[model samples]
Target: MRVVGNYRNPGPQDEYSQGQGGYPPVSQPAPVRTEVNAGRLWAGGVAAAVVAALIGLVGVLVARAVFQLSPKSSSAFGDDATVQLCVVAALAALMATGIAHLLLVSTPSPLSYFGWIVGLLTVAAVVVPFLGSGSLVVRLSEAVIHLVIGIAIGGLVSNAAGSASRLTLGENR
Candidate 1:
């Protein structure tokens, strides 16, 4: 037969470059931008605050009605335990929302970091009443309130963050 080196004529396929198609071309998708809608986030924060306050109020009612725990006078927030817990829950939710926003803008894994921070803060809140000289029922009630507020803020804020996100491909929506 013919010698291998003697076939000097190059075919069309042989002349084709790397990008020419025997195989399909590899194309990378355009980069997308993800941004948080601040207004939506703020609205979500307000809703979370209200919900937290309501949850605290419910806790106060349960403590009084079911457990028969009288509201203890606090040097900090005065005598109305329901009002005090409600205010604390609202403030905590607002603070958590702000922290979540900051984390979302700055971190790659925002919710993960947010959960850790909130969890630690909640633990501190729960432990603070125990460190003070309060009746056992009062301390337990306070701790339970703290736990509920923490859960409300953590869950709601995280969901809000997800809902507030907007995705865009380059300059196009």
Candidate 2:
């Protein structure tokens, strides 16, 4: 059988021989087969935007609640403080989430649905208790809310900042 690319004891005049110059004709060097679809770009970008928006919403609620409960004695959250804190927290969360998506995930997949679920559940953790917590329920409910919010916030931040480093360093881990 004649084998393609076989170079066993090639003749003197054959390519790769001492007489003939090395390297293939420069006309082409194997055209690269690339799959660049606009759909993929749009899907990834929108998914990223949605995650950012959700992070914003969840962060606003959680931050507002936490700040409200801070030891500072204020009858009502000053307009400037409440608005500024929520905005900062939301923007931080959104940017963190987008950065996370870019770093952590290779090839955008359905895995980000997991983020959506976690973000939503984190919001629920806070909202449910505030609406009705008359007994020891307030403490338990707030604890759950804080834990979930912390997890969501921390995960987003870490995923964004440390994804590449973690992947390269933690290969065996």
The TM-scores of all predictions, comma-separated, are 0.72, 0.30
User: What lDDT tens digits, residue by residue, belong to model 1 across residues 114-158?
Assistant: 999999998998898899987898889889988988888989988
* Angstrom error at residue 36, model 1: 0.7
Q: Model 2: per-residue lDDT, tens digit, 1-173?
A: 22345324445566555655454433333432223333443344444444444554454455447654433554344344445534544554555455445534443332365466446655664565466645554456454544454455646544433322222222221
In model 1, residue pairs whose N, Cα or C atoms come closer than 3 Å (at least 3 residues apart or on different chains), thus clashing, are none
Q: Which stretches of candidate 2 lie over 4 Å from their true place?
A: 1-9, 12-29, 67-173
The candidate that achieves the highest TM-score relative to the unseen native structure = 1
Q: Mark the 10 consecutive residues where model 1 has the least summed lDDT.
A: 1-10
Tell me the deviation in Å of residue 127 in model 1: 1.0
Each model's lDDT: 0.79, 0.46
**Runs with alpha carbons beyond 4 Å of true place in candidate 1:** 1-33, 71-78, 167-173
TM-score of 1: 0.72
Cα RMSDs of all predictions? 8.1, 11.7
